[model samples]
Target: MSDKLAILGGKPVRDEFLPYGKQCIDEEDIESVVKVLKGDYLTTGPNVREFEEKVAQYVGAKYAVAVSNGTAALHAACFAAGIQEGDEVITTPITFAASANCVLYQGAKPVFADIDPKTYNIDVKDIERKITDKTKAIIPVDFTGQAVDLDKIMELADRYNLTVIEDAAHALGTEYKGKKIGSIAHMTEFSFHPVKHITTGEGGIVTTNDEELYKKLSLFRTHGITRDKELLVNKEQGSWYYEQLDLGYNYRITDIQCALGTSQLEKIQKFIDRRRELVRKYNEQLSDIDGVITPYEEVYSNSSWHLYIIQLELEKFKAGRKEIFEALKAENIGVNVHYVPVYYHPYYQKLGYKKGLCPNAEKLYECMITLPLFPKMNDRDLDDVVKAVNKVLSYYRK
Candidate 1:
């Protein structure tokens, strides 16, 4: 590959653009979806239950409820946690907007908390500082698949009597203190978007050890309707009797998607292993590049490595992240930025959220760049990314 910067009209790294993330669908995944299509039920069937059980078992959680998507999963979790009007839920502003939006969905106020600059996860101390009499729960995101400080968060939750609804959208396979993320948090939500470790086309789930929460989550997913004889207020009416116990949305995921999810789950360990391998390649190759800082690995947890991000050292680079990002794009390296702080959005600003609320998160947003990472990428693809990054950064180095 030529060393010339592609953005400057020199030879590019590759002919095709490589996306930052993609789903790896195999024959088994296709077959599973086909099987569900041929079956009698397409939604609200045995496949959904089986998939939920598989997810719950894999994460060592007692129950798992599947929802329409990751955002729905967060909303369902918030509803299950009883986050209502006038309540406050604390969460890091560094994550995808859905993390905070879920709180808003419940008519609750989302309190923005700063993040730990090293791990990119919510700072537990900031979470503590944000707690108030109105604070009902904490929605801590395991940003970049790195586990948050669960022990400390749980201690604070216990002391404050706050519900911990962990937004584990980036941490399906992450483990903390030898326990899987879904099992450790009071309630953990996982996304199955194509970019995530697994794909259900577009789906998400919430795992919890509490049966009450499980029931609530199940109800919340399907318009709060339930046919359970024990909970029915009019059980003697008829066998077809069902009741909507509370206000909920139509967030039920289809059986076809769940079947695909189950098949994908069968190979999740392999997928996660490949992701970690790619992360290793990135770290080993980019370590000497003084213009960028690699992601920090936490000692107490094993990340599933959903996204490999590098923060540009602006002081050492002549150009900013935007210029470098465009340069990498020109090189056919599909780099992306994970997030803008949730409060930075116009809607949030209108809702009284200010820009300077979370300084650490805001700073991270300015420099971090997400590089291509997926299980199916070959060694050559990995090399192309590294080469493109080096060429772009080297050209921009002051």
Candidate 2:
């Protein structure tokens, strides 16, 4: 590797460009999808139920409802929580817009909360401060795959009589206090996007121990329709009778996608292990480097390592995050930022959300950078990343 910075016209770190995240699809995964193709039913079939059961069992939850995507999962969870106009939901601003947009979808408002500076999870104290009588729910995101302070959030929910809808999109394999994230919250949501721990092609699911919530989520996944006789108003109808009891959307996940989900679920443990191993190497290589702050892990939680975000100590660096980001990209390092504060977007601004709402989260947004991480990456790939980061940061250090 070259000792000089690539942005300064020196030799680049690698001959090929590396991506920040990607799916690991193998022949077994292909075979699973092919089997689904040969089956009689392609959607709303046995594979969907089997994948849901596998996910629920893997996370120690009693029930799971599969949906079209993570956004749909959040929308379904919001519907199940009964959030509506004039209702408020508390959530951290340091997450994907969908974390808050789901609230908007239900004609409700999303109150912005700050984040824990170290772990980057939602701040419980801020969540409490943002709550009020109008606050009907809390959607705490497990940012960067670290579990939020579930114990504290659950306690607050109890104190305020608020529903807890955990956004576990980045935390499929994460655990809090030895309990899996999905099993701990009132309603936990998981995404199976290509970059996630597993891929359902484009799908999501919600898991809950409450049967009532399970029913509501299931109804919401479909068009609020039900065929069970016990819950139906007309008990005398024939076997073909089904009714649309409540207003819902078409958010069903296909049997084809579920087949891929079931196959991918089989290797979650292996995927998580490799991610943890890569993170350890990142910590070792980057820990001693100046002006770079490695991610912090709380003793009570084991993160799934969905993203490896590093914060730049701006005071120690001569350049800001954008210049540094470009420098690394010039070295063939695929660096990305996990999020921009949700309120900072123009759409939120037009919705009357202001900047400086969550100071800590805003500060973190200015310094954070997501580095390349996935199960398929090897030691040399990790080394190349370290070398590029060191080279860029060293050249820009004040």
Candidate 3:
């Protein structure tokens, strides 16, 4: 059968194409975007402030600064946290490249730590082992929406006088213990990409409770140009007068994106609840599979369920992970891998980063596969995914 025909056939079995993750847009989101489009300020306006305020309030953070993308948010957070040249920033290897690259962008070095095999987040013990006199910060990523062990990390950070910059791009609604991720970290970054819990086309936000850090991030999100007379050493009495303090980029987010984000934020609770339901179903369905290990959540952590990841046990299956991935794809299931270890990339390798530095992350890199899990998925779509997954796994087992 043709690929198109197979996809169409699967569509009937499913409500729609089961994207691994996606944005859930509604009438409110549309109306907000339309309102922004009709308004005079399309770039950096009142809606941006409104959205930032709402996010900060929701996360129990004192301030939030909207930026162009998650990467930009990370950059702003690192800068605001005072990362400087030759300083070492500890982070997990099993994350998006942006997590480590943000440290490099500040002329600092990124030091890799192993991840906790169960949670796939930066291991607090590994972080402590890697910390040195040059260590300046800990960039703990909430991988796959599971909150890292923040209590331990915060304790270590306090001991070392290091800052914590949370790569919470996958963990907007996730929590550690009773506190939210954004509020617990010294600085937290969130992505509003299509694949994230929310969507703003392409946007991110930096959240912080420290007033000084918040002010610094707010300035960095724009052009580091401030119109506030209080920040200026010499006040100029002109409406257009502004001071360019730090070298910054045009990382500002548009009002249109903020409007969309605000709309999406309104439904975040429902989105998170449905995702947990889907995860429960997946866990029940896949738990008995001999060669599969489902993602684990910590007792003290509340995951956002951004992506459902499972590891393939190569010993139990006749085929390799790649073959199983291909089989699922041929069955019209859109499965994908979460990431390769950041240090495995050419850029990091060129900088003398080596393998075996993070054994746990490297092991995960070989077996991890992200299954379709999103707020938009219905019962039919979920069932279709389960059926396809079972078919692939059965073949490999045989």
Tens-digit lDDT track of model 1 for 1-398: 34777778788999998999999999999999999899899998999999999999999999999999999999999999999999999998888999999999889999998988899888999998999999999999888899998999999999999999999899898999888899887899999999999999999999999999999999998788999999898879788889999988999999999999999999999999999999999999998888889999789889998889999889998898899899999999889998988998999999998889989989999999999999999999999999888888778788
Sort order, lDDT high to low: 2, 1, 3
In angstroms, how far off is 276's CA in candidate 3?
A: 0.4
Q: Global lDDT of each model?
A: 0.92, 0.94, 0.88
Model 2 lDDT at residue 393: 86
* Whole-model alpha-carbon lDDT for candidate 2: 0.94
Pairs with backbone N, CA or C atoms under 3 Å apart (clashes), candidate 3: none
Clashing pairs in 2: none
- Once fitted onto the true fold, the runs of candidate 3 whose alpha carbons sit more than 4 angstroms away are 1-17
Query: Which ranges in model 2 have alpha carbons more than 4 Å from their true place?
Result: 1-4
Query: Largest lDDT belongs to which candidate?
Result: 2
Q: What is the TM-score of each candidate against the true structure?
A: 0.98, 0.98, 0.95
Displacement of residue 246 (Cα, Å) in model 1 is 1.0
Expressed as tens digits, the lDDT of each residue in 109-177 for candidate 2 is: 999989889889888988988888899999999998999888999999999999999999999989999
